[model samples]
Target: MSGPGTAGAVETEPASARAGLGGRYARLWTASTLSAVGDGMSLTAAPLLAYTLTDDPRLVAGVTTALTLPYVLFGLPAGVLVDRVDLLRAMRGIDLFRGLLLLTLAVAVALDRGNLLVLYICFFLIGTCETFFRNASQVIVPSVVPRKLLVDANGRLLAAQTAGNEFVGPLLGSVLFAIAAAVPFGIDAASFLLSALLLSSLLGVRSAKPSTRRTGGPSTSERPADLPAAPGSGVDSAGPVSATRPGLLADMTTGARWLLRDRLLRGLALAAGGINLVLTAGLAVMVVHAHTVLGLGSIGYGLLLACQAVGAVFAARLAPRLVRRLGDEQALVCVAATMAAANVAVWLVPVGTGVGLALAAAACAGVTWDVVVVALRQTRIPRPLQGRVNSVYRLVAWGAMPVGAALGGLLSTAFGTPSVFAAGAVLMTMIAACLAEGARRRWISDPR
Candidate 1:
């Protein structure tokens, strides 16, 4: 999971390794896309599977709740592990583990032995692995591709992720599920295996420095891509030389403090969290909503969601241009408003044309938002703290999903899915207003 130009592998690398970078980057991109496809398949299959097992809104939400809960629990620890572990080895191993688990689940389902309890356990484990894989994936990118091609490479990867996970995966998963419930998971398992195989091709990507914590080397940056660096420390040939590494709690706190210390970073984190809170609320129950409110079959529901991915593809191409045109703050507001609009459409119009278009708009703007945010963070965060700070930022943003999942279930139970959508729309609008105000005051300034 090493990504482009953040922190992982030292800034300097040999030209020989950088030669034929495209092929190497393509392999990593394929790995990422394949894994994303599996994730998308699960997003559709897992909740739908839960619904098949039970009719309770709360219980169905529990599936999503279980999947996301680990981000809050294991995120920082996983970040610590990523810094210490070999990126390719860790990614390949995790993929194998996930693939085996899914293959087992597929077999169980085929045998009619699958149960909700088993689903919960499998999902939790998969989510835990994903926590590590995702973080590492980002860190490993810069190591594989040069900085000049970094943005283009990431954009391509993101596009592939969107296409596989959202466009192809959901539609394909729904079709497979219709043919046979075990089929989607079977494909997901295969996808992971393929991804693992692809990881072996990354011969050039290496840790900037092997982490001393695990390698018995000198201190360095604690990123999956590099060794742990002390606060204000410079990169070293032997390893990072500054203060000695702190305990886990203190190390994690240091990363968190760095992010919170900056007003813009703090605002961005809060905004992302708010966005996730409402977004998860809708997505958690979207399958059910599509069934009851929109009166759509699984195929129709899949297609409806696919529109978002289609729009995202376009967004991926244009995000950099849009950010340059609008600047960061205005662009952030656009992202928030677009999401709000999508939820509003869901609340107001249950039909395909309206909801699909709105969702697509949301997806489009959301990606632009993502591109801007990630690019900004890459510029701002020091390479040494990239792993830790990225984890902390995600810990705040993604932590909202579990809470939103639970709240979504509660809201749907109390007032139905439309109400939840309506509430999300309102919440997002308020968030957009706040961001706009901040922008007007020049609070959310560009890090560069």
Candidate 2:
């Protein structure tokens, strides 16, 4: 399957027909966007349902924790599994599974069986599936699109997610929840099913050649052919074979090893993880601020969140251009700095409706940081290791999210919302400063 000019070839249709974008890439883009919108709806609706049912702030935080904790626990293993599986099949399976899970929740809600335990269990399952789907999608992108188009592809994906899922999805979900909690869940379930169908059609479309070299070992082509295969048989004699078996723990360890060995990846993961922690903490507190401090009802809070999503949308749109002009490393530094500045700015705002504007600014910064960083990572990481690296990164970086949520709740309860915002701002600034200095020293380079 390896041939001259084949390595970087794009699988999509003609560029002219795509309005200057690459061919079938547009279809994939649309599918991803719709999927994101659906995901966004669930992000909003799930928490709202949890809160409505329990009316306990701790329980609400716990629900949020349940959703994110998988990144810490299962991300590495999921990455390993992605590498072993058929990328398309894995993605489609995850989407279908997620859809079914959401449908079950919808049924539960309709049947008045939506208890805390059920919600928590569903949340964990959904999070685990998401880890696999996300890793597979990132790994598969370079195969479907030309290497030169990677930044653009990543930017489009981010924009769709920010606009549809984070912005529009949440807003619509909130509205639908107002009408009926089950409605948003139904929409979420449908979106995942649709995404699964689209992904399934893409199966066997592009198959990546197996890496001849193992980690820290010589190329596979260079090795003696008669050497026996590894014990688990992830690869088949017929050709490059997909991992069809379940070995989540071993897979996770593989991801962790990759992260520990790569210096650039390690730094990037640390920066991302730190920022994620702060972001989650801030969000946890914001819910309370919107409700109690601002005296906004659920609808008002949803609108404020929608505004934040709008800011993120704008950031996502602008990130690719900034990266092109400044180069990936510089762009990442700038985005991180911007996020830190925005965080500090939010802290300075007077309490109440003014805080909404502050959060909007912060949201823009956060989105820019997110898009650029993800694009850079996707570009820099080796294709075969993308799943493992992403998983490990998520495990370490996102591990703090649950803790952040808990802390945010505690601080809000003790020192109040202002203190939470202040603490988050300080932490973000420190992280930005560290990353900026590291980037300046050329510790991280643009893979392009």
Candidate 3:
């Protein structure tokens, strides 16, 4: 099955139709990278600050929990909102809102007023906006690029994201945090403001408007008065829903029903959820692990993260080719197996260099998995349902992060830091087995 807007068209288009990702994609890519860098800085700084306030592993991990909790709480509603609104406008507004929030946090920190409560509130709000922002971004990509180039486009985007989010951003953030503890948040605030300015230029290229034609069958009236009007029609395109429009509950049900009826997507979401639950568990206590077992400070920890980012960039560069050769189903299985092995290696080799190498391998597997799954999801989902379905899909895929982080904190508090990696290896091995069995049973399809 192909996306209603892209896949069918890709099948008929000539080889000559292959073109560069174009100017619009470039702008979106830049804006997304800028935002990712800011997010990375904030993420690195937040945990470091938490570590300063308290030595409790659970408290440190709570920062991560706050940053991901909103996905589980509001993923469905965010999907509905993303589907109903103009994506560019929504993203611009979200960037500005998040910038203001970070600015406030920066001031709070500068004034020596930072506390665990304040940090949690700030992270939770940022995470809330992230749910909508990430969904809207994914929904807009297919509109900007050809479906046949989905793998290439997604791989480049993932690479840029890794460089900014993990490589440059975290390294810069840790250095700044060591200076004053407030500089990183201030810098992140500025990045968001700049990103919003970049997005303001793409409003006229193509309006990411939802399909106004009602589902169920063809109809003479494709444009409904209750739906948002197309861009530049001299109407408020993303105004509040009219009473005649489908209610929020109805919209949510539509997306959920579509996802549930698709066996491959449903199974993928469940497997991803399980994998994330364990992966996040290991990551949540990484700060504690670095301090207690590895004897590393902030700079060393940032370098450790940089190792993973470098591996991710390398893998993202190769993901498109790998997918083309191995096919999507096989590539996914390979990623799962690789990740399981990497986690076990970390458990076995607890030294700084050995663990960093293992982490790099895990990051490589992670980016490969992301590029394949995101492209598959984008190409397979319908255009109008992109936001809703992607959100519903990620509701399981990403919503497990906070829960896993919390579990990690509890386990670390009881069993010690090294145990987190050992436990993650076991869980990931189980995920790999399930994925292999699912492939054999034909629950997953190759999107070649």
Tens digit of per-residue lDDT, candidate 3, span 1-448: 0000111011111122245877777777777677767777788789888888988889999988998899899998877765456678888888898889999999999999999999999999988888777766765676677667666665566556666777777898888888888988998898888888988887764544554545211122333433333212223444432323455677677778888988778888898898888778888888788878888888777778778777766775577788889877778888888878877776677688887888888877777787777777877776556656777887888889999999999988998877777788888888888877766765546422
Model 2, 393: alpha-carbon shift in Å?
Answer: 2.6
**Consecutive 10-residue window with the lowest summed lDDT within model 1:** 2-11
Best by TM-score: 1
Which is the leading candidate under lDDT?
A: 1
* Model 2 lDDT at residue 82: 48
Question: At residue 245, what lDDT does model 3 achieve?
Answer: 45
Q: What is candidate 1's local distance difference test score?
A: 0.75
Model 2 TM-score? 0.76
TM-score of each: 0.87, 0.76, 0.81
Check candidate 2 and list the clashing pairs. 13-23, 13-24, 76-252, 77-252, 84-243, 212-220, 273-397
RMSD of each: 5.2, 7.5, 7.3
Residue ranges of candidate 1 with Cα displaced over 4 Å: 1-19, 146-148, 201-205, 208-244, 446-448
lDDT of 2 by residue, 331-433 (tens): 7777667666666655666455566676666666665666566666677666555555676777877888878877776776777766777888788778778
